[model samples]
Target: MFGILVSAFNVALGFVLRTVVVKFILFFGLYFVVQAFVPVLASLLPKSVDIAGLFSSLPDSVWFFVNMFMVTEGIKLMFSALLTRFIIRRIPLIG
Candidate 1:
C-alpha cells in the first residue's frame, strides 16, 4: 500500500510540474513580452480608423459567418502554431 501511494504521488507530482507549473511560467513570460511590444506594434497601425466601430457595425450575416469560422479548429491550430513559433524564437541558442 505504501508503494502504491508513493507511485501515485510521483505521477501526480510529475503532472503538476510538467503541466501546471510550466504553463503558468510560460503564460506570464509570454504575456509580459507581448505587453512590452504592444506600443511598437500599435505604432504601425493607422490612427484614424475606429477599429471597434468597424467591427461593431458588421451585419449579422457577416458576424454569423465569422462566428462559425471561429468555432472551427483552424483558429486554435493557427494560434498554437504562432505561439510555438514565438516560443522557439525566444530561445537564446536556438533562435
Candidate 2:
C-alpha cells in the first residue's frame, strides 16, 4: 500500500514535493519537542499528577520510543533548515 502511494507521488510531483516534505518534517520536530518535554514542564498539571507512575504501568520502552522518534525529528528539522536556506539563497537580487 505504501509503496504504491510513493510510486504515484514520484510520478506526479517530479520531486517538487521536497520543500513541502521538509516543512512537514520541521513541523513534526516541533511536535516531538512538545511531546517529549511535556511531563517535565507539567507545573500546570494537577497536584495529583504522577508522570512516572502514569507511564510506568505501560510498556517499559515508552521513553525509548519517544527518544527514537524525537531523534528522527531532530534530523528532519536539520534537513528542513538546510533546504530553507538553500531556497532563500536563490531569490533574485533587488538592489
Candidate 3:
C-alpha cells in the first residue's frame, strides 16, 4: 500500500530529524551551561587561571557561535549517552 508506506516513511524520517535536532539543541544547551557556569566556577578558583578575563579573547561572531554550538553538541551527545546508560541501569521502567 503506497499510502501506508508513505506514512511509515514519514514517521521514520521524523524520528531521524528529531535525532539531529536533539543533537543541536542539546549541544547548545551544554555549551550555554559551560559558558555561564565556568565563570562562576572560576570565581571560586585561586585566581591564577584568569579565565574570567578570557571572554575578551573571543570575539563574538556568527562563526564562533556556530562552531561552538557544533562542538558543544558533540559533547552533549557524548555525556547524554553516558548518563542515559548509567540511569537506565539503575532505574526500572514500567510500560
Candidate 4:
C-alpha cells in the first residue's frame, strides 16, 4: 500500500509539473518579451502632437458624439473580453 501510494504521488507530481509549471513559464516568458518591446512601440507615437490641445479645440457637439461612441465601444469590448476570460478559466483543462 505504501509503494502504491508513492507511485501514484509521483505520477500526479509529474502531471502537475508538466502542465501547470510549463504553462506558467511560457506565459511569463511571452509576457516579458512583450513588455520589453512596449517602450520601442511607444516611441513610435508622435511626440510633437499636442493631444490635449487637439481635443480641447474640437467643437462641443462633435466632442460629445465622439466621447459617447468611444465610451460605448470601449465598455462593450472590455466586458466581452473579461467575460470570455472568466468563462475560459472556469473550464477544466482549457484554461
Best by the TM-score measure: 4
Question: Each candidate: RMSD to true structure?
Answer: 9.4, 19.1, 15.2, 7.5
Tens-digit lDDT string for candidate 1 (1-95): 99999999999999999999998898777778767765675587578966458668889999898778774466668867886676567655456
TM-score of 3: 0.38
Cα displacement (Å) at residue 79, model 2: 36
lDDT of each: 0.76, 0.64, 0.65, 0.75
Candidate 1: how many backbone clashes? 0
Pairs of residues at least 3 apart in sequence or in different chains that clash in candidate 2: none
Global CA lDDT of candidate 4, please? 0.75
- 42-85: candidate 4 lDDT, tens digit per residue: 58756896756866888989979879789557767996788557
Summarize candidate 3's per-residue lDDT along 21-59 as a digit string, tens digits: 887877677667556765675477574755436545666
* Superposed Cα deviation of residue 8, candidate 4 (Å): 1.1
Write down the TM-score for model 4. Answer: 0.54
* Count of backbone clashes, every candidate in sequence: 0, 0, 1, 0
Q: How accurate is candidate 2 locally (lDDT)?
A: 0.64
**Superposed Cα deviation of residue 23, candidate 1 (Å):** 1.0
Error of 2 at 42 (Å): 0.7
